[model samples]
Target chain A: MQKIVPNISVDCVIFGFDFKQLNVLLVERKLQDEKTGETLIDDWTLTGYHIFEDEDFDTAAARILKGLSGLDNIYLEQFYAFGKVSRVDSPKDNIWLKHQHEGFSSRIVTVGYYSLIDNSTVTLQLQERNVKWFSITDLPELGFDHQEILNKALEKLRSKLRSEPIGFELLPEKFTLSQLQKLYEAILGTTYDRRNFRKKVLQMKYIIPLNEKQKAVKHKPAQLFIFSRDVYERTKRERFDFSI
Target chain B: MQKIVPNISVDCVIFGFDFKQLNVLLVERKLQDEKTGETLIDDWTLTGYHIFEDEDFDTAAARILKGLSGLDNIYLEQFYAFGKVSRVDSPKDNIWLKHQHEGFSSRIVTVGYYSLIDNSTVTLQLQERNVKWFSITDLPELGFDHQEILNKALEKLRSKLRSEPIGFELLPEKFTLSQLQKLYEAILGTTYDRRNFRKKVLQMKYIIPLNEKQKAVKHKPAQLFIFSRDVYERTKRERFDFSI
Candidate 1:
């Protein structure tokens, strides 16, 4: 009797911020058409994989992240699953499917996870040939419903930012309130009254104002601030509301 | 060259309320020990599978739900991905490793989604033997890391309940304030201040008061109310702060 096998896998769309715009990492596909034995034009996509039998889903995502980006110990959170029947346009067009003797089309049920990382920490590895970063706003036409995945990930990231101190991950260790507000505005896709935003931030008492000031801005320099990691940890662990 | 197969699949844990406690649907695993060639005694688990090449992930989940419980059109949402190394204990005892030809030890990654369904809608399919509902608080040891997955799903559900109007799915069409409170308390795993909770619910203006009163309760009969689906949809779509 044939033993049952599970066909499942995890994919990660690593999103990074450079204080200006949102960006995502993508890898170019090298698959060819099976029937015509013709190499298909290269198309960029997210780094992904088939879940190894011995590995956990998270481990697979981490491995892909490390393998493609050469970065580890970064925060990765699963956001959504793409299971639309027509997710992949044609099953027989890919090189991966051509190798299977069973002649079955590829039905990929991918769980998309987004990671927030400071762009400076990212160093390309073997992915240099196949991977590149595209601004979330100026994305090239993608192959799959990756655009939808990115949108959902952005929504989750915004929700996370509202409730947690995850925005700190997108910024330098020390920054100004102006920079902080800019980051929030970028993520929220809307502007907030600077005075109100600052007042709200100060009331939270989670961002400690530093004695230093930013040196390079053209206007009056703003005071620097660092996230109160201790307070954030305590409040987050206790489930305190951080909504603004 | 051997063809690489892209397999798709879905796994679901159906949660139901049993009047006094929350419960989950589970089934038994039929696989035997690989190395010892001995059947493992009484290992129960969640319903899952590999997706057909032509099917979507949501369709696969729906199919699994129907196949296992004979329920259709239930409210199911994709939750977190369970990906950790050793999520499935590998290194099948030495005996199973010896029969390498079987490939039973190949890695499988599963995407876990969950649903909240009224217990009355459950119609078990005779195809499954030993199918039963276990109280979420009193679950037996499950296969793999399913217990952990179930816990994460519950946490997600709780968080979702606070942000979204998912309570409508769990409660009957017409429910008393006390019944609504109990449902919230059960999912949140906390004791809510009844007066304060009621105050907040009423302030939302999304609960339509009815003339009918709940019968047979020990306290004074509570007024019945139905959720305003239109208001809920408008509020949710407008992205108003729904934090309670």
Candidate 2:
């Protein structure tokens, strides 16, 4: 076997939005201890893997994400590197990993990445016993400080959403203003004033109004709008302030 | 012997502002090849070290900075992880590290961090051969991927400056409005309208003016001011718009 690059692993925090709520992709693992030979079943973790010797850092992350989800062209961004000695070297991870894989006999430093995708666009073939999407609010204790990794990813997402229109990635091709508002509310966990929120949206010329409306709806059908990245690139105001 | 955590390192990108320009912290390295006995000298790199077992990632980074520069209270922030497999696997670096350090026989995944400090506040006793501050613009080609790491760190610093009061860290305890403006212009690499810049700054309640002036100066002295963190924390507006 090709010797794995020692002490380096890639973990991905995949954020999915299903219109009303936020979700994260997690993989379930089961292993036996190296020292005690005790078995571990159904332990949940963020989708992660060891980096191959010939791969770039980003390519390694993209490889794991594509292999598991079978999806491509997803927007992935590196958020942080977690290198606390015990992050993987703790007794629990040490024994579990040592027994399962020979290459994992030493301390491992993991690079953390967060990917954003619309939950409705892709289907997950692995579930129950393997991989699943967990709501951002509720999650089980993860293996090897993955909980902290997910927390940091969410923080980056929230901060990025405020300044840029990245939330459009978590949205559909065409969506109503209310649907767009709900997406932001779900991700940010805050309510916005309807008037001000619309004012902000209306001011953004890149959010092009399309001649489409929700079909077969019992309530009033709202007009749909699409995000024009070209327009946004040409006209976004990036004036930074030092009031703070 | 207590073994170092194998294949994981932390590199610090310390950015210092000396009123007129930006400077970065660097350390010189001298190593000999394990195979050919070829000696490499006068190569510059970021202050970095492998993480010690039983230490936190942030704590390890802090320890490295403190140990190298004797600066304990500097503001350090994790920016990214450079995990391209060949980042340290190039034959030149591989043999050099192998001969000098046992813990680095395998691959290295380096975490990059950037620290901000006022240049006037520091007293560098490290003379010619060990450590020194080089202006960010006039930096030589650094060893390994340190140049890429430094570029990434500056990108982060610029983005953070847009939304937060982090640039204050690069300024002295007391400074004139012109000095503060120059700091922003230098860091952002752009010029601003004097009236607009002053208006935006004067509108900030946190930028408090004092009855202080330059004791000795050739030109007319400008009034001095201080940044009030408490006022800023309580009153800063952080509404981000995307009208572009």
Candidate 3:
């Protein structure tokens, strides 16, 4: 029997980029009436579960992610902790909780974790559960304040993508400047001047240019660039200004 | 009687700038032997308490800050959540926990909140609890995992100070360039070239120079400047790069 911490839980918002738009991985939550054998409620929610009493939060989040996706060593980060008393106030959420646990607590504090994965790299083994990636702009009505959670996660992701080089996690190893521009545009929901964007990115010491070009494409082959994290760590100076 | 959540607690790392160095607010945790009435352990820890079930995390953090400082609307930010099972493994911490609550849970997940205050602007009202400000460099062995919590809070503060204009929170409304430079130096633990630093700051349009000058100083009266948050908010653009 798993000893669950009654008041604490963990939720993961896995983000993926497929070169066109930014999407979030969500799991379909379906609850059926025990006695009548009928579907009571069905909705979408982020992948999550109650943390075990003996496990730490990071371990719990990793365990849940691996169980859902069968992937390890992904880019995971803890963004925020949502502790509103009415977070699970929806009737359907309450019903689902009641069915899942006996005498569930009225309040739960959920720690939010977000992970990034390359859309084309690995196969997600989520076939058993109805898991799918939904575009951020066209998300369905998520269950139990998960919409707010997802929104917060997106906000964190946007702020982080602007400053950090974590966006490479969602892109292929060898990528073109256009693909990189598309990624920034997709996540930030804005367009950048191609000339100015390329100039700025090219000036960055960590963005190393490669000798190879795109192998197969309809358009003219573009030069590929690789992000050198080692060079970034070695040559990075203490940043004095953040108002980039 | 106060209703408390056994497993969820909030720890506050209150940072104050005294113009020379960074200091953290700590409460002296003195435990006395029950039968002998002799002081067994005396040490310092951050000001914190278990959150009430009725309120949210922000509300709980604010309430704790207000109760300790008798001040409201100070600059408070939630940085990280510490959920390690062995956070309170020390014998002194365990003894204090046993003295405070009946049958306390073995595991506690503490949300870390950090706040900044100008040391000269307001007087702290923590005399009853023996709370005092200790310099970050010169500190005693803190009880529990408070030292780790304080270090994380400082890391967050350092990171936030570089990218955001939050360093002004520790300065007086009217300050000279030297004072501003000193403020940054104290927090960042590094000295900036005077001419270069001034050049960078002057280029920022939001840092408005006032006609007023310093009064009653030994050296020549330097020009005064105020951080124009209104102008900063109005003219702020979406940042594209974070690598300063």
> What DockQ results do all the predictions give, each relative to the true complex?
0.26, 0.51, 0.51
DockQ of 2: 0.51
Order of models, best TM-score first: 3, 2, 1
Deviation from native of the Cα of residue B30 in model 3, angstroms: 3.1
TM-score-superior candidate, 1 or 2: 2
For residues B69-160, what per-residue lDDT tens digits would candidate 3 score against the true structure?
A: 78888888988888987888988887888787765688999999999888767766565678788989899879899999999999888877
Query: Model 1 — TM-score against the truth?
Result: 0.80
Give candidate 1 regions above 4 Å deviation. Answer: A1-10, A27-43, A49-55, A67-69, A90-105, A120-133, A237-244, B1-9, B28-40, B90-105, B120-128, B216-219, B237-244
DockQ score for model 1: 0.26
Clashes of each: 12, 2, 1
True contacts kept of 2: 0.64
Candidate 1 is graded, for docking, as acceptable
Candidate 1 residue lDDT tens string, B1-244: 3222333336798888755577788886555666897775456677776655566667778988888767678888888765554565634323332443433333445578888887745546437467788888788878766788888888887767766787767667887777777777777777778898788788776788999998887988889999887876666442423110
Best by TM-score: 3
True-vs-predicted CA distance for residue A165, candidate 1, Å? 2.1
| Ranking 1 against 3 by DockQ, winner | 3
